[model samples]
Target: MASGNRPVLTVTGLKKSYRSAGEDIAVLRGVNLAVAAGESVALTGESGSGKSTLLHLIAGLDAADVGEIILDGVSLSELGDAGRAALRRDRLGLVFQQFNLIPSLTVADNLTFQSRIARRHDPKWQEELVERLGLARLLKRYPEQLSGGQQQRVAIGRALAPKPLLLLADEPTGNLDEDTADEVLALARDLVARTGCGFLLVTHSARLAATLDRQINLHAGVIA
Candidate 1:
């Protein structure tokens, strides 16, 4: 690891580009980052600065043009598609701006969905998350019945339920009002601390970044 300590995640000389209008546009250029076990880091940058690209790369949703990603001491470059998929399923948790909840499932079911899929579901942890997220009252309701903030809480709950080693959040508060966003983030940080999981949060909110333990700013496809 970069710090000589075992980091939950580390990225080295990462690069990524996309083809647009018949020309290649670079999104990430020689980017490097790390998140220690149980530490929280905020990733901030303006639009098109590749904040989300870094998260996608770390999550193994997209491949980099060069460099390496190490998660929980495992190199992503060595993993095949199936291995990547398994890693994501068993060791990673994601919270996106979209709050990708199943519309058919009730709040209770949605909260436990990822954990069940990972086969690491703990009834006690699920109950605690439900209480912490203030979702106990909405358990029987479906996603369509909940407001945007409520759905987001459910999403956070789902991500944390599995107690994964690493959590990647991409603008998880994008759709909420400032106050609600703060509340949700508070819950997330608390749960992450409690679970002893490392967090890499991507956000445009400086105020939100301030709440984290450390902050990393990305500019022109590189850490600034």
Candidate 2:
């Protein structure tokens, strides 16, 4: 729909497969994708179209049977597990539908975990984020102490704290009520824009995808 040449991520001939019931199931077949820096893109699909699989592959959480994934000019396939983990820790930000916050940590700790792991923790930026994400008052509260919406906000704060090269969101609003989902999604949009980070969102809602710069649907693992 729109055009840009920033090129933060690129994919070519991507493939993934799994074996089940003594049969080989091919989830992705030579998929190709490109995302520019500072852009927001929506990835949508129906049930079992391999949307999550693609997101996982792009995030370096899963391996591809073939092809390549290049992030910020570095090919992910070339990195070992430790290297990939480091890349994910340092250069990538991830937000999921479940809001995977650690139960033992307080809001502040959860928010700063990624940054600490990546060795990019900026105190000034963290404070601004606490206020901007509306997390200032909840800093001492743990994940169990917050509501679904509040917890999701904390998760978003954690992902953004690291200030990674790219943000990967998988059904980020799936667990919240419509109004709350709207609020969290809005916050995500605002922060991603403010930081000029690239976003690749996997969602089932066409309504949500419409707000992004481009919408690409995954069908049988191929972008349609």
Candidate 3:
């Protein structure tokens, strides 16, 4: 892990609810958490435990009903739509269970897409990611041309290409086999350490959760 004691992300007094059938369904209630630079955390929760809702709020995809999220010292509540969008583009790395690679682009292009658009592209760093992710020989292939594991690797590389301050993954390996999931996650953790970025992963696998530096379970709208 890189040297740093400062937290890359922090959540305080977070609360959210949704109205359903004339009733307000509470999701997250006063949830507080923090992820320090170079630290990896796993969030485990049953379905409807609000894991994805919390992530959406943190990523600025949706607004929290109450409380705040601080990303690299910038408060999410303070940012406008444009600001949030810009932050997401430039400072946050996000990966989902689905390997959302561009089908039209080759592996090299897919890997560099976000960095290039954000104007944060670093040739050296990009090369290092390609090498570390074992994607060098597959650079010429497109997303459909690769296997599930390979495509996921490319997705991870693309997310980390710009060296974001925080990485949020929602069941990133949900579609892969156990062995492949472990391998992919190992690569992700190694890269997170290399970048000194805070990592927050949501997974259902208790075994996978155990590999993280810390594990927290969400239950009944709060961290349990």
Candidate 4:
């Protein structure tokens, strides 16, 4: 890792590959990225340019076949699956394009899910999250009872309630209408900024990417 109060996340020569039908498939090669504390960065790419792969690697949801990933001072290459899982639970938060809320859980329960996993539930924090995410009224309702926008808001609240060191978002607005997407992204950006955590969001929309602190493109397995 690089020294002295720099970025919370850094990558050098990050690579991922797979084998199918006796052929080697390289998804990402020699990608480099850096996201500092409280900074929002967008990863933009055409379909299959490896934007999602990069985010997964950074989040430790998937492994790199080779290369280095350092997040919040720890190298991902050095951690085992169990170690990485713990790190993700304790220090990372994720938002997916699909709002993966549990079907049976109420809004209140879903928002505090991470806290339960980490054994660190704070009722007050969850309450604050409910209000901030505009989920107070919906707290008693289930996922099926909410609209796409409301569901996404709950997803954001769940991710943010953990106070993670880094937040990874993968096409978070892909399913929403333009106005709703903008609104959800706006709330997400605002909360992440207020919490002072590093954020890396993947999107194909130039307009959305433009709203971030910095924007970079991925092309042919490399960051541009």
The number of the candidate with the highest lDDT is 3
Worst lDDT 10-window in candidate 2: 1-10
Report the CA-based lDDT of candidate 1 relative to the real structure: 0.93
lDDT of 1 at 15: 95
Task: Evaluate model 1: give its TM-score.
Answer: 0.97
How displaced is residue 65 in candidate 4, in Å?
1.6
lDDT of every predicted structure (CA atoms): 0.93, 0.89, 0.94, 0.89
lDDT of candidate 3 over 91-112, digit per residue (tens): 9999999889999999999999
Better of 3 and 4 by TM-score: 3
Taking the tens digit of each residue's C-alpha lDDT, what string does model 4 give over 153-186?
A: 9999898888888889999999999999999999
Q: Model 1, residue 162: what's the lDDT?
A: 95
Clashes of 1: 0
* Cα distance off (Å), candidate 1, residue 106: 0.6
In candidate 3, list every pair of residues with a backbone clash.
Answer: none
Task: Give the clashing pairs for model 2.
Answer: none
1-224: candidate 1 lDDT, tens digit per residue: 22443589889999999999999999999999888888889999999899998998899988999999998889999998899998998899999999999999999999989999999999999989988999989999999999989999999899999999999999999999999999999999999999988999999999999999899999999999
Off by over 4 Å in 2: 1-5
